[model samples]
Target: MSQNLYKTDAFTIEYIPGADILKGDFLRCKTSDEYVSAIRAFKEAYERVLPRYTFWDNTRFGHIITPEEQKWTDAFLNYPGAQKGITEKVGILVSQDILAMLSVYEIFEVGKAPLRPGFFANEKQAMEWLTRKETPVAPLPDTKPLIAVEWDADNAKAVIRMEMEAPDLPYYLNRFKRFLSDHDFLVENLRLFQELTRRERKILSMVINGLNNGEIAEQLFISCETVKTHRKNIMRKLGCSSYSELLRFGLFL
Candidate 1:
């Protein structure tokens, strides 16, 4: 059976109250072109989300931080709130393959000694090292793995779905935010739209802006009864009987 990767909340590190940790992804690539593409994508994402995070590029061996990057790290390190808190510490991971190619100076900058930042061969190791001081993370089941979703949009609305089995619901939701933002669909709130015919997406778009059933009916060009039926289906599919519960799903409209 496929194990649930998300269910390991106890093992996953949580953001400290005021510490802003930005995840910079660097996936393994088989070819130079593939590596270039991954680098470009990571760079673009980092720049776009810079305002919200202290970005760290995780590689195979350790983190890659430069003089230019020190400005962001310094700001967070100097923040009174972060300084007084234990959650402000941030680290990076570099792949073992990439580490072998680094120059002595570059490797020195990333390794211990002058730079106290932790290094790891993989993300799980990096996160474990970073969070080791507080509590030891449990061993992860090799079976269950993190899953990704792809969303498709149609005319002002997006249809999102997934197929992986998960152990943690909240983590998957949090992970989806990057996809939502990448597609420019991240919004404040969402509501159950439709249950049958995959109308939940349309309803989410409408409800995120506080649309009532009648308004949704008009916008969707359906009768009030039909809209109600759709709502019922949505509630059933989502396992939520109340509008409040539905909104909490946080679908970006």
Candidate 2:
């Protein structure tokens, strides 16, 4: 059985008792205020209901999140009492639009949130994944030291291990920063590609394939200095700090 927790012109949220999950279906674009209200409602219901409820978000008709809404969501989820240990898992089903998928991906990558989230293209797969029981691990001995050092005869190297009962806040925050930074590079790369001239795209394609500036210049019949200038402009436009970063971003190309 499912019960309606909240509903509006833009969205509907329901609690599915059988699956122990909250389902949020977005029907249309929403204003910033509406979006905030919806999130608040979801949080309130999450607290009021049983603990460890999975969240199934269906955003086939949802709009992209604005920067302001994104900030608010980050703060809300990170609030001390907001969602600490209440959610078990989150499964998000996104629309066909790439931008819509990216918007939802941004939320998951923000991190430090209580939920373990995964994105999916369909509801059935999402549900199956959410309901699957993970193999349990026995708890570590409390008497173990925080850090242990051992000699590995096979590798002929000293191995150091730092054990923790749970991941610290800083761990998740750093992960969030890395995920967002990498995705930001990819997004910028796509935008730069769109802004590039035909000749520039050709040069960028070569660069992505590991061509040196001099090689690109020779192949394109351009001056070496001109190739260097083009490379500089490409880096600037894509906001990549190093050639390696640019190469990683090139995967999207």
Candidate 3:
């Protein structure tokens, strides 16, 4: 059974008991305050429901979080004593826009990246990532210390491992390294933002927004060959050797 806990203009929060998951679907928000309010409501429901895992879909979300809002939100979500009571794994199905994503990248990447959270391109990936748990049977060949946390029967008690670094890049970028499936889907999605020139960014934006070479060329008043060259460069930067890979990566990434 599923319980629709609350619905605001910007988002919806629900408890899906069949999967024992708390789900949040963010539709859109005009401002940071509105986004925070919606998340605040979700946090309240999170305390009340206390599901096993959480999955947040931000596919339709629009607000580009400011730096101050990102810092506040990171602290607000991971408050004192909040780690133990809340669910262990969190999977966020993130926005496709690279620019919009830069904002969210800051929230999780600004601090030490805990092992519990993952960012995915779609719901199936997110849910697949969410249900995954680490079961340490024995020490591996690696020298890194492994800490296995345990919880009570009701799962009201938990010892969450924290304070580990994810990566200098957005955890989303490095998170694919931890995914058991699909090693090839790992893309340098940020390379489009990080490496591209301002003009290239404009061209790449058009490319991701579903424009063809000729169309982008016409809009930007550049030659189609120039657009093609830019697209080729972007594909190279994203580690995509083919157009299909680039298109798929751009659409979902």
Best by TM-score: 3
Q: Compare the candidates by lDDT and give the number of the best one.
A: 3
lDDT of 2 at 48: 68
Per-residue CA lDDT of candidate 2, range 86-107, in tens?
4566666655554545555566
Whole-model lDDT per candidate: 0.44, 0.64, 0.66
lDDT of 3 by residue, 126-197 (tens): 676566666411111222334567786696898744332222224434353345334444353544446767
lDDT score for residue 135 of model 1: 38
User: lDDT score, residue 237, model 3?
Assistant: 70
**Ten contiguous residues with the weakest lDDT in model 2:** 135-144
Better of 1 and 3 by TM-score: 3
Candidate 1 local lDDT, residue 4 = 18
Ranking by lDDT: 3, 2, 1
Candidate 3: list runs displaced more than 4 Å.
112-116, 135-253
Clashes of 2: 0
Which 10-residue window in model 3 sums to the lowest lDDT? 136-145
